[model samples]
Target: MNRTNKLSVIGIAVFTGVAIMGDAMLSIVLPIYWSDMGLTAVWQVGVLLSINRFVRLPINPLVGFFYRHYSLRLGISIAMGLAIVSTFSYGIFSQFSILVMMRIVWGIAWSLLRLGGFLSIIQLTSKTDRGQFIGLYNGVWGIGSLIGMLVGGLLIAETSIRFITTLFGLIGCVTFPFVPFLTPSGKKEPTVQKTTTDQQKPLLALDQFVLTLSTSMVMGLLIFGVFSNTLSARIDQSYQDNWTFMSFAFTSTAIAGIIQAVRWGWAPFLAPFIGKYLDHTKHKQQALICFLLSLSALFALIGSINQISFVIVLLLLFQFVSTGFVTTTDTIASDLAEKGDSIKVITFHTIMVDTGAALGPLLAFGLLEYFPLRVVYLIASILLFVLAIGWISWLRKKQNDPFAFSVRK
Candidate 1:
């Protein structure tokens, strides 16, 4: 990479790290904060953490729409500015309702940043490098959470919420100035013509748009419902006597990240071999991915039972497999996207994924409330099975004319 590319990469990494730190604090620390504030209801804690995603649902599509019109630089800068303002205000207000409002604003900011930053970063790289670049991108977010949790835990022990919030504010302040350097300089896309005309072409296909949208939404449900919420709840309930299940889950996730990084480090070399087999196999890549996803669902079901400590350890292994599998799916999706639309595809995917993640808790809560944890896990597993079957059926129907993927071109 040249100087400009290096600068862009660094800028993205720094911004991503800082922004994720705030989100990390919320995820890893806010439950304890709610406890301290006497908001002990599981439902209330779920709302406090999840309201942001509900707010983000509306905001994400709009960010996608705007990116179709404006420069990524402008959209992302605006989003970062909002994050900076919101981070500052978070500490100023102590009221639960007010904090919820701030979290909503923060969600909007996150939508913009996530969509714009992901797209922009994709645009900055070439087809050959996208997987590796995305791997790095994904790794940074995990690293950010790891760092933030470590920092937040210490701050809560030794200092105050105000101090911690201020630290995040300082991080935002430091990151703002570097945004300009992140802008892509190598490519100049055609500016939109101002001439009035009928029959304007849509920037993305309807099928492409809808499928990617579904993919994003499902991703959110997978994260919030199954991966994070339901799994945690099941494990927590299983070891109610110990109070260490959640801690172990967190430790497992952190370890999963490290394991994922090690795996991702070899993805570039490994992908070619995998790709060769995928290309030759009768099963399409998309269909095979769906299979892996089904396996993930199966693992979720197994983990949700909370059989024993040994079983939980086995579940953690499954969790690592799921993470690695998702990473691979993302690489495949990015590879298959239409030309010049990598960013939009990714943004749409993020929106769906986050939507699922946000709803995961509420879904889990509902399931757990209405039925046994095992039943809830069974239903989730069924859902994943349906997703796989549905997607595979679609692919089979369209097999004669494969999805017009950029890589195939």
Candidate 2:
């Protein structure tokens, strides 16, 4: 690899680590902060968590534009700077509105760093290693999440949320100087003249982009939105304690991250094989397989609610495998990106993921409020089935042309 490649990879990993750490810290500490401030409703907590992502739905595309037209590094720098300022202020301002505003600001910062880092990685590496590299990219965030939760847990056990937030803010600030190192220094390849087929008709490009994003949205909704949100709530109910719920959630999340990291190193070797088949095979069938297996996790969760130890263990196992597919599918979206708009493609992916994250709590809460827990799982399962049908139809249409990406250069 060239110097630029090495520096960009390292810098991207560091920033990813920081973002995950920040995320992990907020997961554990923010609930505590909310409770201490006399805010103690599941809906309120859900709002606190989900609103950050909801705001990102709009700002995420803008981050993509900045990355595409301007410097990814500059956008990342501004984002990190905002994160530092906003997180530090959390220590001094304890009001609900101020805290929500800080989270909104943090969401924008997260988009910049994450979207930029993903684009940077795509630029720095070749298509052959995309899965392994993307896995590595996500793995870095996993490690960051692990360390953040470990440290945040320790601090909250001994100290205060304010101190933890301040400490994390300092960590965010430290990453600013590293942003300059993330530039892609390699030259772009000389253009090859296009055949008629190479030049797609006008609306086709936009349609493909939207389809890729819709696939991303479905995947994100299942993984981040439904599973994460409902599972957390289920664990909380079983344990009847916030700390216990967080403990299990963080541990499981950390473990999932580690497994994903390890998979990153190995998955690329299989990527070529998978890509060949994935393009021709029934994606919807595979998607159905993914969902069916994922729903089995709800069984484990239901068992956990009944105080079955082995069932909770099974739940974590399901999470591990599900996340592996999630990571792999993410790389698939990268593969499907418009030729030159890799950043925008990935940004749309993130937005879809964030949208799922935002919707998880809302959907879960709405279901829990109006229906039984098992019924909620059934509803989610039905949605997954619908997504599978969509996937199948999409794959059948694109079977002859898997590398269907199209965009203006």
Candidate 3:
């Protein structure tokens, strides 16, 4: 990458990191204050956590459409403005209804930020280094989430949730000046001449897009949606009264937050390696399958095992495997995006992500009312395992086709 592209990546990474910091802060803060915020039922937490994703689902396409016609930096600046408002509002309002409204607004902001970031990185990097760049973007920006979780936890323990939340909002506003450094949308470079075979397979491109979208949706369902909400609530419920380690000084929520931080912290160290491997391997499909299967197994183990130690280990494993799948799927999507269509392709992919994230917790929590936790996880495991198998079978069928689309390392 050139110095300009590097600068763009850094600027975008900072923007993404700050935006995610707000989200991570809420993930830690919201559950602890669910009842305190006038919410009576348990299901309400899932609803509140997921409603933003629901709002994001339909708005992503519009965000993409707008990117095609407008400046990316402008869109991102507007998004950052909304993020500041939404983060600040969380502290100002305790009412569930008002909180839900703020979440809706935050959803629109996230859609713009996410789409803008993906388009910017894709436009700035060459195909040869695309995976590494995307991985770097995710890895670097992910630190914001780690900081948010750690600092939010400490602040909640020392001062107040409202104070910490508002502080994060102000921190988000600090990214505004960096917006001008982002690469503009709809800017195109000269294309290399393609062989007749490469140019003849639009259907193959569509197929790859569908596969990548499906993988992204599953990632949303398992990683972003179900695990985050369910596990945090479980920890809070299990240990809220008097659970702790290290001489029983810390509350379970604090411990959980630390664990969550560690899980996120692993990404910056691991994503670059995963990206490089994907960029150099022909077995990308097999690697993805393995990651999915491993995640499915880990989910089942977590559900079946009740021991805290075992559960923690399983959760970490789940995080590791899920990270692999997420980076791989994103790299695939980036690979499949045709020139000048990054906005459209990324928007659709983001829609799938939002759809699954929106529905995962809502549906999982609803099922929890009727089923045991183990059964719920087992169902998720089975579903993902089936997807892995189906994907492998599809790969086998396409193995012999000369025009078949695959991510080449």
Candidate 4:
């Protein structure tokens, strides 16, 4: 990468970390603080946490359209401004209605940031280094989430949720100045051209695209949507009266945050290796099949096992597998875009992600109300295993096709 590209990546990564910190903090704090904030039902917690993702369902494609026609820097800066405002509101408001509204605003902000960050990586990095850069970008920005988890826990235990939330908002504000450092709108660099067939009908690549989107959706549903809420709820129930860490006396909220942190924070180290492997290998499909099968069994185990230690270990393994899927799908999307218009492919994939994330909590919590927690996870496991089989068949068929879409750069 050149100097300008490197700086753009760094700037965007820093901005992403700051932008996501508030949401990450809330993910840990919200379940613990739900009752105190007047929430009575488990489903309400899911609604509060997922409303942002639901809002993104429509907004992601719009943001992508805007990226096609408008100023990327200006759009991202405005989104940052909204993030700051929404974070500030979280500290000031206690009512459920008000909190939901702030979450909506934060959702719009997030859609912009997510799309902008993705575009920046795609536009700024050279084709050869795209996977490595995407991996690095995800790793770098993931640190923001990691810090949010740790700091949010400590603040809630020692100080106050209000203070920590507002502080995170202020931190988001600090990234406003770096918005100009992002790649300018409507800039495209010349690269090795795609074949006539590759350029003629991008939709012909739908088989690969659909598979990639399915993986992304399942990831959002399982990793971000279901596991985070369920784990926190489980911890809260299991340790109702004894809500403090052993000897150290840290609050259960802190412990929950640590657990969730471990789930997300390992990406920085793992993603680069996964990305490099995909970049250098042709058997990406086989790797993904193995990952999905492992995840299926692990999710089943997580549901059946009652021991907290076992559950934690399973969830951690789930995280590792989830990160592999994330890296693989993203790399695939990037490769597909290389053959045609990137914006359309990325927009469609992001919409699938947001849709799954929006539905995860609603579906998971609803299932929990009717069925045992084990059943919910078992259902997910079964569905994933089935999907894996279908994906394997699809890969076999595609491998035999004369003009199959290649994920290899």
lDDT of each: 0.60, 0.63, 0.76, 0.76
Give the winner by TM-score: 2 or 3: 3
Candidate 4, position 160, lDDT: 79
Question: How many clashes would you count in candidate 3?
Answer: 0
Candidate 3: regions farther than 4 A off? 34-47, 94-98, 182-203, 233-246, 249-255, 401-409
| Root-mean-square deviation of Cα positions for candidate 3 versus the true structure, in angstroms | 3.6
TM per candidate comes to 0.76, 0.76, 0.87, 0.86
The alpha-carbon lDDT assigned to residue 3 of candidate 1 equals 58
Residue 225 displacement (Å), model 1? 3.0
User: On residues 333-361, what C-alpha lDDT tens digit does candidate 2 reach at each position?
Assistant: 76656264466568779989888777776
Q: For model 1, what is the alpha-carbon lDDT of residue 90?
A: 55
Q: RMSD for all candidates, in order, please.
A: 6.1, 6.2, 3.6, 3.7
TM-score-superior candidate, 1 or 3: 3
C-alpha-based local distance difference test score of model 4: 0.76
The pairs that clash in candidate 2 are: none
Report the error of model 2 at residue 260, Å.
Answer: 12
How much lDDT does candidate 1 score? 0.60
**Candidate 4, which segments miss by more than 4 Å at Cα?**
34-47, 94-96, 182-204, 233-246, 249-255, 401-409
Indicate the TM-score of model 2.
0.76
Q: Pick by TM-score: which candidate is best? A: 3
